[model samples]
Target: MMNKGIDREIDWRLRVFESLSYPTIILLPDRTIIAVNGRYLEKMGVEEEEIIGRSCREVNLRNYPEQKFPCAEQGECPLARAVHTRSGQSVLLKYHDVYGGEGWEERVFSPILGADGEVDFIIESIRDVTRVKNLEKMYSGVRELIDQVVQTSVSGIIAADRQGRIILMNRAAEELFGYSGYDIDNVNIEDYYPPGVAREIMRKLRSEEIGEKGKLPITRVTIRRKDGAEVPAEMTAVIIYEDGREAATAGIFNDLRDKLEVERQLKEAHAQLIQSEKLASLGRLAAGVAHEINNPLTGILLYASMMREKLEKDHPLEQNLRYIIEDTQRCQEIVKNLLAYSRQSNPTRQYFQLNEALGESLRLVRDQKLFLHVKVVEDAPAAPVLVNADKNQLCQVVINLIINAVDAMDGNGTLTLRTYEDRPNRKAILEVSDTGGGIPAENMSKIFDPFFSTKEVGKGTGLGLSMAYGIMEENHGRIYVKDTSPEGTTFALELPLVPMSDVILFDSIG
Candidate 1:
């Protein structure tokens, strides 16, 4: 009963198969077209009645003079081998169509076996995979091009996972970090950066605190080299993702040793120029001192003018008296300003309050109407921020910065003055910020250079800030511009704080 049921199922399968539209062709064990559906007969350009009893040679393979059917006789074909060995197999074969002479076809032959383990029939299915094959070829070519590019790049490229293990290191990376590509793969990235710097960076990365796109987090750091020397470098990192998951981070580093040396040399050159200007101004003031001596002698001339007006009625010395008075007053004013500009004049060094110094400087410029249209804001802590600096020199620095701020604003804008303590190193800081046309990029490097002024001719000698910088340096302090943008510029001065013991001694000496 089971045998009968199996036979019945097989007969039903053959009946259902003939109803399909695909070109289904069944080949007999003798390599003859024993059965075919309507689609097969249409594809092969043969009548169903004529092809059922015909051998495979009549429909095709007639050109093979050596084998009756090249597929079966050669026994090398996948379908042929499967039939001979009574094992199932699949193989791709190319053939020309008789009706469509210009087209070629790829056919898949699947061999089937009987219960006796002999070849029963073969089912062939065909498809055109030409477009898919072309796409595969294009992808392979692109991969080859990318491989060539990476091999020849000059910049070092390194990628690491969230765990800090390196996944990729190019040839340049091998030379830069002093490790071969093979040695770095799977190694921790911490071995490159200075101790603790790597951990800090990783913490920021985990917290998403790094700079956003269109910006860079340029942190100067020291990286360990293969020879054990730490190299100064500016590092930049970028995050990468794959399939919506964080995959790794890529880092690129540039050497800063040469750039730093160049900046140092420029600073030295600028310092020398300032020192020369200071000496030159001293010489000019010395010549003016000789002329100033005539001021006291001119007082005698004024008394003679009065006597002449009282006793010498015939002389009429009124015009001479007027000339003497005018020249003497001019000499006195010159002598006063000359003393102020001369650095040789010893300014009293004291623990002066920053707010007092700012008040003094503002008072000097306040009488002028230049600041009328401008808003001057002062933001400082209430605590006394005292420093050991020459009182006049400190006032001068503040005055120069304030005047420059006014000039930059070009008549109407905001100016800010602030003071605070640099607690870490025991320093007091004063900052002057202004809203105005900012300095140009090219002139920024030369802003502190003596006589390098951008102001209109006769409006500036550019010696004010240069002098300010020199005075700050002499007091064991430093001054610099923090930033400049379209909005404005900010100048900052940091001076070391004087302890209470020194302040008392200074006041006693005074």
Candidate 2:
């Protein structure tokens, strides 16, 4: 019964071998080919009858086994080594087909031992792994480049979809937005902007409101921070292209904080200098007038007081005496103001709230002739915009500007005062604008020259703007006309919070 079972198993194995798809070849211990499957004969382009009994040197690959191919003469061929060493061997091999096309394959060859305790035949099974290896190489190169590019970029680079889903981001972008690229993927850009800013910016871009012929596409925008604060940024975005099609937008972002801060400091310094100059000029004018006018006024007042003491209440002399005394006192007051204007008074710098200064200046001008026919508007922050400055001096600068605006309007137009901190540079700015006939182009440049005036002779000495300019310079700040249109002109007073070191030293001596 056992012998019958063994014979049955051998018959089943032969049937299984013929049904296998993989090419299998058997070689004799003398390195001769004894048999090959139908698939092997097809691969070699030969009939089984012609190849089955041929020597490896005849039917086997001619380019191998005699030093013509890799691993052949070294006795490292899996088939040869498997039989010679009586063990199993596996290797990769390249073969040239009968038609001369190259093919790469992996093969495992094993020695089949006979009952006599010696190798009987070597069986080899082969497979192809070409496509898999090529794919791995391609993917590896791509991955390495992606890592290198992300690390070396400077500007914040971001690539996202229309839905604001972040698809690609570089290190600079990660730092600028204050969010990790990994964390921002798929997040909306709206999450980083003020309520309407993002939408408005997009609308502008689509409408070509920002970029046109001869215009740059660069934009100043406000970005919303994760902490609910808004930060200013300048961004430039270009439509990416791939194979002549619009792929996505690649945006480069620059944080505006530093720029805005520098602007603020410059503006503050300008305002302070203007105030200083105005005051110094006033002081000098006062000193000159007080000595010259006070003497005459004092004589007038002395006579008037004596006349009042001697006159009866019902007498005509009393009325005239009272008139003289009152007029003399008014002259005295005018001289005092002039004195205040002419002298140099060092400013006590501190964190001053801008809104308060603007309010006070407006109130000072509200009842003036210039404001009588003009509509004045104040668009300033509600918060305390702390800036390093001398409060009194800054207030004087604002007052001067309001008065100048009112004068520019001739008491018959609209005046607007706007104040805010330009966060990018950390500087505060106050813009005073008037809706009046714009300054004559020719006169605009000279408007700040000392004693230059366009008003009626007695109405103005043309000293106000010059004084304003001097004050701004002394305080390490700048004041200039930023823009003008048919409707009116805008005067922008840009100041810095802290005076520069040079400014401090110069002011000390001045």
Candidate 3:
């Protein structure tokens, strides 16, 4: 009858038990193991013959010595409690894994009661939870790393909620905006930007035209600091979203004051380079014109004197011949002056720069009403081109030329002033160009003559260019018309460049 009842119990419960997910073990009421699933044998590294018909504790102790629970001395175990209560119970168990790591398993005991309500058998199922626990640990480590990065980044970082309440800020953000790490909750992100700027940023963040959706590309904008002073900055931003809905916005800002200053300086340097190139071309042309004019003027003087010598004494054209000789002499003098001014040394001249003088002169006259409609452009080189001249007189010469240029423009046109080194000739060139009706061809020869005025009598002293000519000679420099056309005129000044090896510069470079 006992055999029949056990067979009936096994037939009812064990029919579909092999397909259960957890590893299973079955034992009789006396604690002798009767059956074990394939998973149980595999998990324990033991065969069914080693566990079947043997005391469960004995089988466990023989296979896994570390699992030996002293049931007699200790309180009643989970298995014993399930047996006494004639019900199912579960207790979490810890075990040393085969790889020497610790792992967890939930062991559940379910008793099978017979017709007399006596516990006939116990079935235990084991569920391992080690992989889940490891995954949780990994997630915890990754979260900590992210928090550390947010707090320690080098650029300013800030975040706000949908209502513009400041939610997060890093240490860099505090330093950049001149704020301390206190009462951040009271600060509003809108305060960091000029009025309406913060709203514009949000609009850009939501627009896909600039960057991808929910992002703002790096942009240059003005930022207002805590002290209310505006500052230049570059910023990038992104909208933080949850489940495809706008949640918040975050931005990274970097101060651009120093960077902008550097860019301004670079532009100035580039302008200087352009002036140098223009001067190089001017030098080549000036030299060519001087060489071409000097030889022909000397030849004319020689042939005309030979003709005067060949004339008969007291001839009918004697008086006219004398006038020709005298006029030719004057013409030769003028030609000499036009080609090249005297290069003889002047003991009175001292080293100075057209760069400073021209700049000062421009600044002095640019604000005048005469220039209200004029576009003034300047290009001055980095290296100072020292000239042996009087500083004040050079400044006056620059002022005179600048006024002449603007007057030529008739109150509205571009005026370009440039000063650069003509290194090969050991000279510096100052060029002033004007967009105006050019000097007429007939008036060109008489331009530097004294008291030669094209303007109305009261409107001109008539001595500007002639006085500039005298000053150039005194300063050991050359002044001439570089080019003239229907479009405009450009005047060139060639001043001696003091060599670095000769001048002992106290501060500035030679």
lDDT of 2 by residue, 68-110 (tens): 4334355455666776788888876665565876556777788
Task: Please list the C-alpha lDDT of all candidates, in the order they appear.
Answer: 0.72, 0.71, 0.78
Off by over 4 Å in 2: 1-149, 152-154, 161-164, 189-216, 310-314, 344-510
Cα lDDT of model 3 by residue, 105-216, tens digit: 7778899999999898899888998787678778889988977898788889988898888888888888888766685777789999999999888887777878798988
Candidate 2: Cα lDDT at 462: 62
For model 3, what is the C-alpha lDDT against the true structure? 0.78
lDDT of 2: 0.71
Q: Compared with the true structure, what per-residue lDDT tens digits does model 1 show for residues 170-242?
A: 7767877889876776468988877898877656555645567422377777888767789888877776878
What global local distance difference test value does model 1 have? 0.72
